[model samples]
Target: AEAYPKVKRNSKFKVLDAADIDFFRSILSSDELVESRSPEELASFNQDWMKKYRGQSNLVLLPNSTEKVSKIMKYCNDNKLAVVPQGGNTDLVGASVPVFDEIILSLKNMNRIRDFDSVSGTFKCDAGVVMRDAHKFLHDHDHIFPLDLPSRNNCHVGGVVSTNAGGLNLLRYGSLHGNVLGLEVVLPNGEIISSINALRKDNTGYDLKQLFIGAEGTIGIITGVSILAAAKPKALNAIFCGIDNFDTVQDLFVKAKGELSEILSAFEFMDRGSIECTIDYLKGLPFPLENHHNFYVLIETSGSNKRHDDEKLSAFLSSALDAKLLSEGVMAKDKADYDRIWTWRKSVPPACNSYGGMYKYDMSLQLKDLYSVSEAVTKRLNEAGLIGDAPKPIVKSVGYGHVGDGNIHLNIAVREFTKEIENLLEPFVYEYIASKKGSISAEHGVGFHKRGHLHYSRSDIEIRFMKDVKRHYDPNGILNPYKYI
Candidate 1:
């Protein structure tokens, strides 16, 4: 494994022993309990999706049911052994991986759709259920999971809820906090707390489920989820617009929301650098435009009335063109075209990292200043003599994101991860976002990556309250120790 900066293991947590392994083996089948002589078997669980953070965990427990999970947690908590609750392992931040020798508690084996009520359009399922599988099941019942992402094929529903992932369809369906009704979680002490309710409205005291929705597994392990699915739209269409300037991009967004109104599902933006990186990474995949523009916007509409949606989108586009808000544009003629257009926008993440490494910052900024951070970082790197072709640690800076929601993904692609480059970015990026009254993290939680930098976005009192909540739930701090509270 690649060497990363070493993080000291908490002295309060106990190191796993043979007795602990024996206990896990007793409750789980051989297949469920993984301990390999070769280190490669546990590599997937030890390293994060970004391959930036690595752990030295030798054991990974895959409980087949919540009961098994409770038993394992109870033992770990009693022994004060640190545990990392992991799902699909698709987290961008370093939250899913162990920081040291902490045991990995994977939920992959517990995947199962428990129940679905067609009349109520609510579904209950294990936390390990893949997002794509949930979407397919919902589609069969003429319903849809409100969240949608490029990693849907592997990302688990519980994982998204844990991170409160706001994906492509967030603009139309809202966040997971609003859509998820209840959850079944395993506390650090192995106590099972089930708030699984199918009711749409509940005036009960203290909606406790919300606490764990975006807690990032520091408080507890989520085993099951109850979410309200959305009704499938009858018609969907997409359009790609090339804008001459960032100001015009903002104008187009305002016009789109006003004209497209309720039918607008997504409004994503990509700057020139983002598009160039995507085009380079996806070799042979042409840009959607005939001529290069300073900025690009992907607008999508979904509604029950196909004719009405199509007319609305067309009128909106015409108005945008008439006002000279966009320089060029293209509308999808069919499903194939729609998918192709979205591919360009979704390809930016991987493309930015295609060179060697990518330093990602997912931030919520004021609409007009969304892309300003990326530009500032690029200028700073250039001034520091870090950015260049090969041999240089830094490559280039790119920005893209859900424009309508003011969430910008600022990515700094580099030839490799180096302390010099990291030092230049940290605190600098956080301070800039704080100055703009923007959040340090928008969707991705403050895992191991942003734990120390929480003050950038939250007040001291807010952080203190968060720490108190952590202590109340997991007094021993064995559940995901060394992570953000």
Candidate 2:
């Protein structure tokens, strides 16, 4: 990876020395404290999943309990030592790693399933627990976590809360703000705030837990989470539809809502470029449709009866074909068929990166104008002479995302990360989103990469209020500094 511009470290923060190491060594076990400078142990922690962002932190601390985290935070606060709270480190926007030499505080060792109430379907667990494990635990009890992501096996429950992640299941279960009941956070000043309530409805003074839901660990470290779980559907089905143009894609979505009604769980859209990339990445996997189409949609239905749900989905697909809303379609018949259909959708992220590098933009737009941004970007790149298959700095442009929620994932697959391509995309893309009154970032938060670009989505007054809140909670600015407020 090319070296990114360096951010200056805060001079007020004290440099780590032997004395600081000794203090950490006293409170933590030998295995818990990873202070070695060896690249082997620190390599994974230093680089993000995309390998686009890299940090040079010399020390990494793993605390097994909340008490240890509190103590370490207190010491760092008193000494003015900066800290970065990391969980899973699967964040795409570079929020979980250090910018310079800040200490790495990892929550991997604190994973524990604290409690689960089968009657009310409430779950309480440590923040470091993997999302897959939580979902599996709920599945055994006939319940399901409200959230599901492609990175579920690696992403932590707490980390998802910190970013307010909205995954494929979001169209059905809604966002985490509604599912998350309470949180246990350790403030930057070493103060612990525990509001782990599992009640369905509670009209309290102020909803304090909402602050840390998407704060990205700037104000505090989320230690635990209490969330409401939904009952698992008895039957599930999925279908892949191919359409001739974007207009048909929109019409299909509108018709499915009315026809499928309550059984519809997910509606996803993918362009031809995205499917081409997937085919290249996942070789030998059969494409759903035989004929080439401009657009494709993956619709999933979940209900209590398999026979009834299948009949409804079949009728919906048949109607769509009769109306010419779909050119070709295939309904999954078994678990093997279902996985094969979804493999096309879930494999998009890695396929985007199969090229040398990828610049990803996740945005929320109006349903009618969802694909306009991607089209405009492709035109701009071609005009700038930065797009091609060989020798050129660019590879191709693609767009795919959860069309049900109007979130578009626009990816610019490139030969390498170059300043020319970035300069053409930054404010240009941000301005386009702002003009349409859409959020610059949908699921991915404004981490280090999008810090300077927040103005495109937020007003100056709003940013000021956010900064004031940060100062109130983290007076020293020692918690995830040099990032967004």
Candidate 2, run of 10 with poorest lDDT = 1-10
Cα-based TM-score, every candidate: 0.98, 0.98
Model 2: residue 7 alpha-carbon error in angstroms: 2.9
Q: How accurate is candidate 1 locally (lDDT)?
A: 0.89
lDDT tens per residue, model 1, 1-485: 24645557688888888998898988999989899577798999998878888888999999989999999999998999999999999898899899889999999998999999988889999999999999999999999988899889899998999989999978889988789988999999999999886478887788888999889999999999999988999998999989987788888888888889899999999989889888888899766789998889999999999888888888888877888998888888888999999999988888888888789999999899998988898899899998878788877788889987899998998888888888899889999999999998899888888878898889999999999999999999998878887
Please report how far candidate 2 places residue 251 from its true position, in Å.
Answer: 1.2
Expressed as tens digits, the lDDT of each residue in 143-187 for candidate 2 is 999888889999999999999988997888889999999899999
Candidate 1 worst ten-residue window by lDDT: 1-10
How far residue 405's Cα lies from its native spot in candidate 1, in Å, is: 1.3
Best by lDDT: 2
Each model's lDDT comes to 0.89, 0.90
